[model samples]
Target: MELALSVLQLAVRILALPVYVLHFLGLWSWICKKWFPHFLSRFTVMYNEQMAGRKRELFSNLQEFAGPSGKLSLLEVGCGTGANFKFYPSGCTVTCVDPNPNFEKFLFKSIAESRHLQFERFVVAAGEDMHQVADGSVDVVVCTLVLCSVESPEQILREVLRVLRPGGAFYFMEHVAADRSTWNYFWQQVLDPVWYLVFDGCNLTRKSWKVLEQAGFSKLKLQHIQAPLSWALVRPHIYGHAVK
Candidate 1:
């Protein structure tokens, strides 16, 4: 009887979280874009350099995925606090975007000052809005740990494809729910409620590669790994590059 009740409770646990997750997601979408900037500036470095550092090495074989790096015209959507800036090769001209109000003044200040591109804010193309950029002008579009927070993952990827030139590449790193692990499934199911609220709009189970494939990034070079600290439970991470 206790085991049956526990199973029933787990079932309820799974069904109940999304309601709150969706509700909190709405609240965070507004708060995250406006939350503390200078403070976040300092904090972003910790996450930027730490967790993102590990994820970056997964793309070490860049030549296989993104081609050569010189004279490249790249766009980074949801370029949170410019963590990915130093990772990009020198010759590449990057146009980066993030909607955070903090992003403009404090987060992307360095990006706005880059000599490589004539324009300011790099790309500043928010996921919720991508009409600002011209079609077929971009050589690479990157999303590192960003897609999990996008307002509409499907529409944002559509815009990514729209702007990228034929043969242009999409490089990405993200976390998703783990398959084959009951513990991971259980915690991802539990913490996801508070998770989406506190940590921006990031989802614990959004398989970004599948989302990319469905959005027509048909030529894909992909990798999947685990985050050292993804959730308190399952840290499933996905890393890959797809060509448009």
Candidate 2:
């Protein structure tokens, strides 16, 4: 079975070489930045509704991180369409970072609607390399549905740790690989190449929790749950917080 799966995966990758070249030429990036956010904004509404309780629980401690200004300094990496803005505590001063410059307009639109939260600035940079953000400058760092797609989850976590102040928190929610014993795992491996092409580098079979565990956080609390996503491939999820 393993050999057969590897053969299939190789065949898929060979067939996908052309599309991969287009991605290399930035065609997919242009399409994703220009159009993906609109579709994601609609999907976020339903996703947020389904995961509201979990999100509220995750962000319940944001007020504890408030600085002398009586506001939490929060950084959100991969802040696509600013979808997590509504879940944040009021009075949070947010800095958004994303590789896609096109998300700025939509991010500002979300900022306008989220009157309770204050927008600091939007930085166009990848999560793994955010030199634009100063080190140890944020009280909190939030990431959702981002790890599976980043080129290096470990590097991103390192940057997350570097940006967070001592005793600061890092909150994350990510869809992860299903159990190896399950049929879902088999399908995930088979579909990963095509899914990565269509969804702009999102892998269907990343065990993101392992990266988080090895990220060198001082304290970590994580749990696995099934998100109410229409796509079965991305239903398995992990969410929790880590302290730097």
Q: Model 2: runs farther than 4 Å from truth?
A: 3-26
Top candidate, metric lDDT: 2
- Which residue pairs show backbone clashes in model 1? 95-123, 96-123
> TM-score: which candidate is best?
2
Q: Cα lDDT of model 2 overall?
A: 0.89
Give a tens-digit lDDT track for model 2, residues 18-78.
Answer: 7778788978777766777777778788888888898888888888876667779999999
RMSD of each: 4.9, 2.2
* lDDT for each candidate structure: 0.68, 0.89
Error of 1 at 227 (Å): 2.4
Model 1, runs deviating above 4 Å: 1-31, 36-43, 51-70, 109-125, 230-234
lDDT of 1 by residue, 115-233 (tens): 44433344456775778888977888878777887778889888888988888888887777677456676556555655666566667767667777788886887767666662345
Clash pairs for candidate 2 = none
TM-score for each candidate, following the candidate numbering: 0.75, 0.91
